[model samples]
Target: MTMNAALIRAILRIIGASLVSLVFVTIAVFFITAVLPGDVADALLGQAATPDAVAALRHSLNLDKPVLVRFVIWVNGLLHGDFGVSLISRRPVLAMASERLIHSLLLAGVTALFAVPVALVLGTASAIFRNTLFDRAVSLLTLCVVSVPEFLVATLAVFIFSVQLHLLPSLASISDIHSIGSFLASFSMPVTTLACVIVGQMSRMTRAVMIDALGSSWVEMAVLKGASPAHIILRHVIPNVIAPLFNVIALSLSYLLGGVVIVESVFHYPGIASLMVDSVAARDIPLVQICALIFCAAYLFLTTLADIVALLSSQRRHAA
Candidate 1:
């Protein structure tokens, strides 16, 4: 097949796989939430709830229906863009999740803005200076950072920045963000915690790709021909490694969708992850299902986009 046709076929395959994965995620989320302990009625009514009252609430919410039947109904609703009503609050799930989703997106965006550039620069510099003090230091730092769990990093950030230094607030409250300074203060800890991990991962992956690019035969030929390191990197190494770097960045950023759950919980951030935690605690299966599915869909979308980008880049490289 022509390279263009091959690339198009690969992109179509990625899209199809992503759609299948999303459907499986929806089923898994619905079933997993369905099996969790406790009932929404019990959570909402607390000690005041009697058996009869609980039964009536379940019936009203259609919780009395069979699990498979409920799954089918939920899937049908999803196809129509209906997330159903929140079991506890009786509000539309979409209405409740939309704002929280935006908050999560904002957090991810801010983290990306800070992390991506730093990762790229550090990765490139480390690759160029491979095995030197700077590269060794960076490698050690990333290793240590990656070894630590995100929650620990988050806790240490709160302890050091908020508790000890008193520079930033521990809670990332949106209501507290009125001015630019306040906005920075509110986001500083969570953003730092997230960026710490993402930067470590992206930089490591980028460094590996760049090192491989630098070690290529053309790069060696450039060195033999008296090319400067800067010229070799800018003109040869970077272009060759751009596709892999894109994949690394996309994969690393995809973690934010899932990893933000811990960070959001720690900071009491009013984001979709926090909302999902609350819904799960309340046994709000529908809301939990929707939230989980959203995260899965986003993750799949990013990976699929990265695959398409890498495929197109390969075609261009071949044509060149």
Candidate 2:
């Protein structure tokens, strides 16, 4: 088949697989959440609530329905952009989630905006200076950072920056940001912690890719032709490695959604992951489920987009 047809077919397959994966994600999220300990009604009304009151509250929240039935209802509502009501607050789940999601997006987006470029530059530099002190230092730094958990990173950041240095706030609350300086101080730690994880992963993967590319016969041929290192890398190596680099980037950034949970919890940031933690504690099933699904959907979307880009890039390279 032609390259165009093959690329189209591959993209369609990726999207179809993503949709199927989303269906399973929904099922798993629903069943797992349904079986979580503690009743929503009991949590909302307290342990002292009468059985009749609990039953009435459950019936009102439609929690009294069969698990499968409730799943179907929830899925149907989800199809219509209705995430149902927050059992504790009596607010729409979508509205509550959207507010927190925006915070998360800001955190992750800002993290990516800085992380990607820094990672690419560091990785390329390390690869170019392979076996030198700079390469060893970059490798060691990434390894150490990768070995450390985000919560630890965040905790150390707080202790040093907030407690010892008194340069930044420990908490990343949005309400405290009254000016640009406050905004930076408020967000700096959380963003740094996240960037540490992302940059470590992306840079290591990028370094490996760049090293392999640099060792290729074509790269050697370019070197023998007296091409400048910059021209060879920027014109040839980067073009060839773009697909793999894009995949590394997408995967690293996808970790932001998962890692943000720990960062949010440690920093007391008002993001969806922390909201999910609260919802679980309050037994707000709808809110918890929606938050989980949003994370899953984002992961799938990034991976699917990466697949498409990789396919197109591969096809273009082959055509060239």
Candidate 3:
């Protein structure tokens, strides 16, 4: 098959799988929330409320319906972009979820903007330097940062950056990313905390992968042919490892997503992960399901995109 056709086919397959998995994810999120101990009705009514009042409330909320029926209703609503109401808050789920999702997306975006190119450069430098002082220092620094828990890192960052130097705020809560100063003021701590682990891991992994690529026969031949170091590394080394690098980048992005939960809580950032924690604590079933579904969807989307990119890289290698 032609490389283009193969690449296109792989892209479609990955997207199709993502969609199917998202469907199952939604159903699973709903049922798992169903099995949790506390009932939305109970939480809404309170412990002192009458049994009759709770039953009426359950019926009103349609919690009295069979699981299948409720799931069907939810799916229908979801198709129409309605995510039901938060039992604990009585607010629209979609409204709250969308707002928080945007926040999380923004955090992820800023983290990526700072993390990716820096990681690539660090990885390249570490690989080229090997066991030299620069390489050892990079390795030690990354290992130390990676070993630290995000919450601890966040606390230390706040203490040093905010409390000590007063260079950044501890808690990030500004609403406008469009305002440059405000955006930096709000996100500096959380983004630094959130991106650190991912950056560390990616840089180390990329270095390892690129080092192996650079050590290969083809790279050695290119070097013997008097190819420029930059040309050989960029064209011969990186391209050979591009597929694995894509996977590493995708996994790092996923790490950033998962770490958002911890970092958001530490920084009191208003994002989907924070909302998910609150919803779970309150046994807010609708909101919990919404948040979980979103988390699943976002992860699936990232991995699928990674797969597509890797597939294209593979096809290109084959064609070459």
- Find the candidate with the highest TM-score and give its number: 2
Pairs that collide, model 3? none
Tens digit of lDDT per residue, candidate 2, span 171-196? Answer: 89898889999888888999999999
CA deviation > 4 Å runs, candidate 1: none
lDDT of 2: 0.92
Error of 1 at 162 (Å): 1.7
lDDT (C-alpha, whole model) for all candidates: 0.90, 0.92, 0.88
The clash numbers for all candidates, in the given order, read 0, 0, 0
lDDT of 3 by residue, 1-320 (tens): 57667667778888998899988888888888889997777887788999999999989888899989988998999999888988877899879999999989989999999998888889989999899999999999999989999999999999999899999877888655568887888888898887789889999999988888888999999989999999998788877888889888888998877899999898989999999999898888889888888888878988998888888887777778
Residue 290 displacement in candidate 1 (angstroms): 1.1
Which regions of candidate 3 deviate over 4 angstroms?
1-7, 176-179
lDDT of 3 at 239: 72
Each prediction's TM-score against the native?
0.96, 0.97, 0.92
Q: How much is the lDDT of residue 52 in candidate 2? A: 99
